[model samples]
Target: MSTLNSSFGSRFGLEYLPTSFMVRMGKREMMVCRDFRKRFYAVNPIMECDTGVQAGHLEVLLFRRWLLILSKSKAH
Candidate 1:
């Protein structure tokens, strides 16, 4: 396996390591990977607007909300 330093060095055509751009990542720094299984229609490069996916997301959010409300009411 190619090390991070070697890959980056080779890309720049440099034989040795680069002193700059070398920074450590924090332990708590999370890499949040979004679920891309569902393909949503994109109106623009920044915006996605798929009716089916939107509906499903809404349905799931609503169902969870209702369940929480019901559980709280039952506990009272």
Candidate 2:
């Protein structure tokens, strides 16, 4: 998993991006991508976990926004 994170970080030049990526264990395998928008379209639903139970949904949303801000800053 660290290897995957490192590779992605290197590719995007965002060292903290991979930190937002997560794997959750529940009834099935789930993953949260570093980029929130990509997760909705490109990522499989099976790789998503229900965060409502732990109130983590808000954190995820905030982190996604942060990533977007970081990307935009880098773009300019």
Candidate 3:
């Protein structure tokens, strides 16, 4: 499979995964990094989409080192 380049949409997706230093979207979760010129990074898991095969791109963004995951929905 081809790797995805930086894009606005994919960058937004990374927001879902908190505490992620680098993220790359793909058929399956793969290793991704901002660049080979940085230090002090955190590793996060990448979630796989349940959609069918289609053209897609991965966007890598730099998140906070102490990022926290917020609750998706409030408990009733």
Candidate 4:
């Protein structure tokens, strides 16, 4: 995807798993997850329109050196 269409910290090549989980190297606090999710939805509009997907549910967790993103459904 083009840089303009990419999410924040895209230069790091965020790691997303098959289990609706994502890991990245950053210092993101829980309070920022909502804002982050908003930006994400903005870039990937399909997530918002797809009825079969539960894109609004996003959880951010901090585990030592990794920042984890957990969602109800897998995202490309």
Best by TM-score: 4
Which should have the higher lDDT, number 2 or number 3? 3
Taking the tens digit of each residue's C-alpha lDDT, what string does model 4 give over 1-76?
6322213333223333222333333433111222223233333322222221123434333322223433332223
Candidate closer to the true structure by TM-score (higher is better), 3 or 4:
4
Instruction: Compute the lDDT for candidate 4.
Output: 0.29
> How would you encode candidate 1's per-residue C-alpha lDDT over 1-76 as one tens digit per residue?
8443211213222234232232224321111122223334322333332222211211111211110000001111
Give each model a TM-score.
0.18, 0.19, 0.18, 0.21
**For model 2, how does the per-residue alpha-carbon lDDT over 1-76 read when each residue is reduced to its tens digit?**
3332221224334445455543423322232334433443433333332233222222223333432111111111
Badly placed stretches (over 4 Å) of model 2 are 1-26, 36-59, 65-76
Best by lDDT: 3
Clashes by residue pair, model 4? none
Which 10 consecutive residues of model 1 have the lowest summed lDDT?
67-76
Model 3: per-residue Cα lDDT at residue 57: 33
Candidate 3 segments whose C-alpha is farther than 4 A from its true place = 1-27, 36-55, 64-76
RMSD of candidates 1 onward, in order:
18.5, 14.0, 14.3, 13.9
